[model samples]
Target: MLSSLALLSVVLPSALAATTYDMVKEYSGSTFFNDWNFYGQFDNLTNGDAIFVTSSVASSSKLAYVDSTTNRAIIKVDNTSTVAFNDKRNTVRISSKDEFDIGSVWIADMYHVPFGCSVWPAFWSQAPNWPSGGEIDTFEHWNLELHNQMTLHTEPGCTQASPVQTATVVNSTDCSFQDNSNAGCGVMDSTDSSYGAKFAAAQGGVFVTEMAESGISVWFFPRSSVPASLSSNASSFSTADLGTPTANWPTAGCAIDTYFKAQNLIFDITLCGDAAGAASVFQQTCSGVCYTDYVVGNGSVYDNAYFDVASVRVYSVTGMNTIVRVSSALGFRAGCWVWGAAALSGAVVLFAL
Candidate 1:
């Protein structure tokens, strides 16, 4: 059955509500809709899921769009037709116009989140540099998982043991190359409603990520629970006022300022990648054949694969280059976009994954 979510009430601390943070960047409505640069293509060979099409092709295929309903950005996976096992599924992947560094807070207002079988959608942040710049997976939803995942990827010398908040479930503490690849130090939000169907049922809401001198933290507010100050009308939004975070990554064992730098916000939907496709359940559904076979055969399974984002706004303390006015359709490309080139062309790549 299709699920829809409602708003959750959030009680703001009296002391925090009085304060305010400057609203630096706001990506809402149609004015800034076209400012996004369309990615022609990107290949995640290490995961070995499927090939992605360019933005133009994605728009043509109804996988991506921006209009009245999608003025904020609506991206989805191939659900309109029966796909061939060999044929790649259509999807949408996009990045913000500008690069954001530490001490920035991002709030994503979503109406629908990606869910369903063989689906892996992520809204993460990363720098142009690979492991050096670091990556933070704010919300990575996999059909196989029951909770929301928050991970940080960086070079060697980062651990989640000390300084890490115990509110969430810590998987691996190491943010370095655990197995020649940055598996990342990650934690899971045990709240069932924090992701997927539960989140969708709540009508989706806000995802707040704040990177400060202390560490990185994430908060998810369902539509019913969004902070009053952050709703349609309020002076401004601030991290101090939001109370405690759902996921917090302190710097006792890690130097967040060192690893995490200027990064672009990203959103993408991938099918049968290294994580989802490699699972036994993923293979079991496809008649003992390949994961792609199941995904191709059960095309209707992806009918709910879509992202109806209402808003993506960024706030800053200093208010540095806050808003990103839309430039060309393909404004500026991030170096990280070419993450795996040689590996795709059949050659040795510096960063394995």
Candidate 2:
């Protein structure tokens, strides 16, 4: 009885703490498109250069489909149809059927992204209620520009000053919408190789976004530089184990939990409206031609306008187990994993019986 009572003291607390991450959800494979809700019609990005942009998106069209060759979801902007002076170009905008809350990790594996003149492609997530719910842009680029940008847009009073990563450029540390730059609290890759043609030349890569108590982090892993743990093809993994991220937005001066909440994942393509055509944008890519004219008239230029995605895996924070070390008289402490308190108590009672 004495020995058993001593064991109970140590084992009870440890059992309640030993936990592990479980794969709560997975959206993988070509058929994965079936699980997503496609937004046909026009793009919802009504601000910026996109205000002038319209959509010819259709539900059963090639603008969004599953490719047979690579078994990846192929989302594209239409360059196949005839375009007039004022016609909306064909494009695709889709989103996940599900929504994710805070403290989740999102992994998107892609093969190609729609790129080039007057084009804008983005993979992002946003909550239902504007800036109050927070926004995360995992992939965004425009025109002939050769860099990838990851931005976070949130309500007022949120500013991040996390340690900068190697070669990462911080465009703004404040995510509030009041900033004139609209750069948001974001970061950009130093080299052009991480986006557009150069990124395609290297066969695409993985973009991972992890949202936890520490704030938000975005990491880009070129196909050649992917980690072994992620390459193993598991349904879920801990973001804490991913080491240093390419972009880290720690909640040092702000409470990220207060500003951000459930968000719907979205993928969209728009042409010559906000960012590309704005008077302030780097519009030199169009040369003497008008941005809209080139985008609408030059139908053949968008032949390669598309996003090829292999899969998007989502993981919840419940995966991280709380490890409480316990040393019994027998000194059994090495890798002895148990469970919650209620389960352990019941087991001890049965053992006594």
**Leading candidate by TM-score:** 1
**Per-prediction TM-score:** 0.80, 0.78
Alpha-carbon shift of residue 10 in model 2 (angstroms): 46
| Candidate 1 structure quality by residue, lDDT tens digits, 1-353 | 00111111122312212224566676767654454555556445325344566767876886777657556667887776776656666677777777776767788889778876677788887775666778888888566455677878888887664433324345456777543245466566657777777888888888888777567878877789888877763436656657777766667677788877877788877776655554443443233333555456546777777888877877775545434343344543343221221211232112223
* Residue 152 displacement (Å), model 2: 0.9
Cα lDDT of model 2 by residue, 157-187, tens digit: 8776644354344555667765523446656
Worst 10 residues of 2 by lDDT: 9-18
**Clash pairs, model 1 backbone:** 4-201, 5-201, 5-202, 5-203, 6-202, 7-223, 7-224, 8-224, 8-225, 40-54
**Colliding residue pairs in candidate 2:** 21-319, 48-274, 49-273, 49-274, 49-275, 50-273, 50-274, 78-90
For candidate 2, the clash count comes to: 8
**lDDT of each candidate versus the true structure:** 0.63, 0.61
